[model samples]
Target: MDITQTTSVATQAAASSADKSAAAISSDFETFLKMMTAQIENQDPLDPIDSADYAVQLATFSSVEQQVKTNDLLTALGTQMGGVGLTQAAQWVGMEARVAAPVKFSGDPITLSPNPVAAADEVNLIVKNSQGVEVQRQPISVSNETIEWSGVDRSGTPFVEDTYSFYIESKENGQVLATSTVEAYGQVTEARSQNGGTILVLAGGSEVDMASISAVRRVD
Candidate 1:
């Protein structure tokens, strides 16, 4: 099902659970009250039950009842927040999101965001296929920028269609400085709630958490 429908189902399930809990709490409260009343009515006239003990019992029941109500309110709030999250995630569909993860490359070129170390004088972009084998290496600008990969190997031949990952290595005067980070771009094809969080399904068949997206832009 779609994200909206999935969220609705989850909300309904939470509401049903809350309703049952509330009902059970109410029933138990009523039974306690009935028992307390019976005890008071059947108590000895000369040796009546201590009023202080009854007060304590009543106070405890009141606390439990209040807790149950609080739980119900919190559950409702959670459902509402889930709905809002689903709404926001839905907007990501059909958009391109920049995330720090590997992505699939079918014939289309993939965009990579390279973050180079500040002290480095040179930066290199390393492309690796799904098997973790280096396929291409190219010197890139030292500045943090987005670079496009045409899925070609070192010999200028296009790599076969598969998932690939990118890494950035920064160097200073031929000595390695630091291995920087790289971000991948993908088109969001679907959004859904999973395990109390929203997941963005990319067109490349990869799933990413909504919170993991660093940047988003509409697909032209």
Candidate 2:
């Protein structure tokens, strides 16, 4: 296994074990104190408990208690570090991430990253409105290069300001081969952690997991 994976597993196991161990140690310490007190109180004055033996028992319990405290501190520190990790993820804000999410049109050209199929001889850009209606269809180059899409209709009239989805329709000899949702670069508005994974909120209020990000770049 990878070292990072092994370390993560070990850390999680240690954290879980620490909590259980702390509880058990606390119970044991209480029992030990009660037993010691009962013995001291019931002992005869002539044959009293030796001070040296009592010291040894006290020192042992003290060491065990200290160990439990140390474990508790480690657990707390782990939690703090997890929070710090999310703080670091905040740096992703303001950057552009390539994701397959709707692009919010607000009187600005949206850049789309369309990936046409290799077997496609022709490709067409299919624009869908917020209500899932096909608003426009136009031919586009069958290449992986980014395309700037103006949020307008065939007559060069701007559509209503709303979220729009783009799909790439691939065809071979006028027969539709496949249509797939295209990815677009959207600026990150926020970064947060959820369910042990990082999530990036796009400018259009769309949330995507870190794993869904295809590429990231500066908003130049």
Per-residue CA lDDT of model 2 for 47-108, tens digit only, reads 99899989999999999799878977777576555555556557678888889987677888
Question: Which residue pairs in model 1 clash with each other?
Answer: none
For this target, which candidate reaches the highest TM-score against the unseen true structure?
A: 1
Give candidate 1 misplaced runs (Cα > 4 Å). Answer: 34-48, 173-175
Q: Worst 10-residue stretch by lDDT in candidate 1? A: 2-11
Write model 1 residue lDDT over 1-220, tens digit each, in one string.
8766777887888888888988898899889989999999999999999999999999999998898889888987887787788889898888889987778888888888888888999888988877889887899899877878888776778889887778999999999988755898988888887777788888757788999999999867
Q: Give model 1's TM-score versus the native structure.
A: 0.86
The global C-alpha lDDT for each of the candidates, from Candidate 1 onward, is 0.85, 0.82
Backbone clash count, each prediction separately:
0, 0
Model 2 lDDT, full chain set: 0.82
Q: Superposing every Cα of model 1 onto the true structure, what RMSD results?
A: 2.4
